[model samples]
Target chain A: MGQRTMSDQELVQLYLTGQEKALAVLIARHQDKLFSAIYVLVRNRAVAEDILQDAYFKIVSTLKGGRYNEEGKFIQWAMRIARNLVIDHFRRGNKFPTVTDSEGNDIFTYINIPEENQEDRLVANERDSKLRQLIEQLPAEQREVLVLRHYADLSFKEIADLTQVSINTALGRMRYALNNLRKLIEKHNIAL
Target chain B: MTKKITQERIIQFVYGELPFEETAALFDELDNDTEGLDYLESVAGIGTLLGSLMVSPSKAIRDNVLAFSAHFTEE
Candidate 1:
């Protein structure tokens, strides 16, 4: 409470010790990355923002009540909270989070492609469309792994830890994802 | 007679999941093999472009988050 510069772990300690502002700092530190994670799943900016706020509310109340473990892995714990909220939102909306659209279309279908005649630009656009379509075609399990691993920048170990899958299992899903994408590309003759 | 790399390994490599040593070997292979290099570059480019397509949340959304969090401090 006295302007003490604290590490995230120390901040968590302050929150547990009844200093509320410390909790605010912790939330601010994580909000952007956490929101980005939620947004990628929900793909709805408003919904992601809402979930982020709700996550903080839950984190604060839960921590102040001594319900949090001080395992020094507080970011991951908060991430778990944000992940649950995203899942709940999906369930409540009845839309599979990775599916983008209920009709099996890639959500990026609405993405506007800027016009350009350069060979590089044309190829890049074609590739972008193919990639989105391929990702949409992936099984939900594989898609989740790819998104969390690449888009969210989670390590394989972190992904396994978060998803509760073994490391090899996570890696396997990623493997299937790539194979499936290649197959889809070949099958569709998408000129990437 | 070229060995086939699984689509999974290709994705892993594109996403930077391959081990450093494996990556160096893959890089060498890609440099010497036109087909392999083309395929990898295409897929990696697609991955990059798809991710860049999303618009960052607007300022209104950011303000909403700030407002909501402000409730705790306003007390």
Candidate 2:
């Protein structure tokens, strides 16, 4: 089987057994979602990047020290570390520079639709940008639950554990998030 | 008592969070309830749309992490 197709657990095992390239494969597989999860919380690209690097460094150290026991839960384990780092960043009152585009507008204010995909790109991009903006408008609690569930690929139960809330509360937040998004879409007549 | 399917339950159902029996029951109800089915479609659509918002760390960050991990193998 190609290294790309290996499961996260399998890759970790390979890395542990001295196949160093396995580590790179594992990181590549999860880098987007993991980084996006941190970015959503931090809302600053540079700070999120720093937190992501720190999280990866810690992940390597833990794996090397044989301290990682989660096996198949590598992403979640790493995400928890990243999440804690974000919390620490907030706790320290460290100010994150606002991310802006070339026009000096907040990056989150408008989506930069990628031009890679040809057909259906325009409609898809607009819909995506609208949905992103609506999500950004959601209450922080609801948005966190939504981001963790959708972006982080975490279950509501895991989200509850990470966010220090009950399972029901997590479910409730997600429900509210969707409901709010639906309302926003309807109110704005978003065609998606 | 048959659990009345609320929006919350619909959310759970869409995400496959309902228990097997509850899921079976919901599916049965969904076969008859056009509104429920539409709601499910909308929620699922939003979930898919959220996929476009996924962001990756810059290549520089990836390289930094890889470089950092490289040291562990060297040691």
Candidate 3:
């Protein structure tokens, strides 16, 4: 079996067995969802990068120390680790201290959108930026639920269990998050 | 009598976490309820917008992570 498709569990086992590249495969497979989950919560590229690094460092420690016994998906386990790092960040940083985007160089904002003229793309870009700003403005609790549900793909029950809140609160926050975003979009007259 | 849709069920329904029969039942239920329909549409739209959201950490950060794995040379 020269070229075998490895499951996440197999990749972890391979990495444990000293095949280092397996970890890279695991990271690459889930980077989009994992990084997006952290980025939306922190709302800054640099901080998100920091939290991601911290989360991965923690993952390495736990796995290498023979302590990672998480059942189910590796991405879910990684997502929880990332979310915990974000929570710790907020706790340490005096509760959402208006982080400025020092690394405002997301390559996606460059010539990314295909099949659109410059003017139309520019309008869409403005709308996207506005939406990002509104998401940033959301209360941290609301944003947490939003990310866990939309990005992490967690049900409200799981979110509630992790967050130590009632399922209703989780659902309520999600509703309010969307409603607030909708209101902000209307207030700014930004069309998506 | 129409079933009263709680916020919990609506959220589950929105995420398609509800069972097949329950999902169909709520779909029909939501069709008759404007507020529920609006919530469903609102969240679905916002989910799409949020779905487009993502950011990649710099290569340096990812390298640092991958490099950490190399430190473990033995099983």
Candidate 4:
């Protein structure tokens, strides 16, 4: 290919056609988002990192073998792989062990603060950590709907399609998620 | 010419999940009912907060992803 950048679909096509550069580009493009999603599920940096590697290896192998057919969906497919790896990691008793890295410990511990202005960057980070904690409190079904809808930016119809639920059910789950979160915030006196 | 709206329908209204006629009717109800209006506002606030819940990965996560990506580059 020329200096022109390729779309995810094009990269996938090239990878399927035995181009090594395509896989690298695709991995480079999605590595961060995939890792973030995996981190949410697994809650451990090292484990999430390990799972990301497994996900990339699987993605390259599957694409190169022509096993993945959906176009423009490389990230979603890679995320599915990463998610499965995280689930398997948890199933196998994976644990975080307290973070030893000073920077890692600081970021992870910053979740405990309350009453910060959104205009401040550090406060914005605190808000994110609070939201993640709120999500963890949600029931699994509702949590899944919230993550798929908000984080993945999947439409309700797309989520229903992915989760094999009816559109109405997906909407209802989101409704419940919001209601439950509202209750949790009130009960815990969590400042938003 | 309007049907009474319930709290349950407020979410669908705010999120635009309702059909056009229902949305119009809900707005009409809001104009006449203070309680419905308050409920609508609360639900909207919840939606706003929930919508902001996407968290950026922590530094460790960033480092891990970068390192993991580099491995693919190396191999």
For each of the candidates, the C-alpha root-mean-square deviation to the true structure, in angstroms, is: 6.6, 3.8, 4.1, 6.2
| Model 1 Cα lDDT, one tens digit per residue, A53-99 | 78877776676555776573676777788888888886786553333
Candidates 1 and 3: which is better by DockQ?
Answer: 3
Itemize residue pairs with steric clashes in candidate 1. Answer: none
Model 2 docking category: medium
TM-score of each: 0.64, 0.81, 0.81, 0.65
The residue-by-residue lDDT of candidate 3 on A94-167, one tens digit each, is 34333324444333443334426877666655555567778888887898888888877777877887788998
Ranking by lDDT: 2, 3, 1, 4
Q: Which stretches of model 1 miss by more than 4 angstroms?
A: A1-33, A70-75, A96-134, A182-192, B1-13, B28-36, B60-75
The numbered model that scores best in lDDT is 2
Query: iRMSD per model?
Result: 4.7, 2.8, 2.7, 5.5
Q: Please give the distance, in angstroms, between residue B41's alpha carbon in candidate 1 and its true position after superposition.
A: 1.8
Q: Which ten residues in a row have the lowest lDDT in candidate 4 chain A?
A: A97-106
lDDT per residue as tens, model 3, B1-75? 222345457767778777888888777877778887766776677777776665455678778988877774334
Residue A96 C-alpha lDDT in model 4: 38
For B1-75, candidate 2 gives per-residue lDDT tens digits of 122335667777777677888888777887988887887888888776676678777788778877777776524
Local error of candidate 3 at residue A98 (angstroms): 8.1
Which regions of candidate 4 fall more than 4 Å away from where they truly are? A1-7, A17-33, A94-106, A109-127, B1-75
Q: Score each candidate by Cα lDDT.
A: 0.65, 0.77, 0.74, 0.63
- Each prediction's number of clashing residue pairs: 0, 0, 0, 0
Lowest lDDT sum, 10 consecutive residues, model 3 chain A, at A106-115
Q: Give the per-residue lDDT of model 2 (tens digit) for A1-192.
A: 655567889899898887878988888988888887777677676788899999999888888888878844777788899888988998999654555556454465233446556445655545554565677789989988888888788888888888899988998899888888888988878754
Error of 1 at A60 (Å): 3.2
- What TM-score did chain B of candidate 4 earn? 0.62
Native contact fraction, candidates in order: 0.14, 0.70, 0.60, 0.17
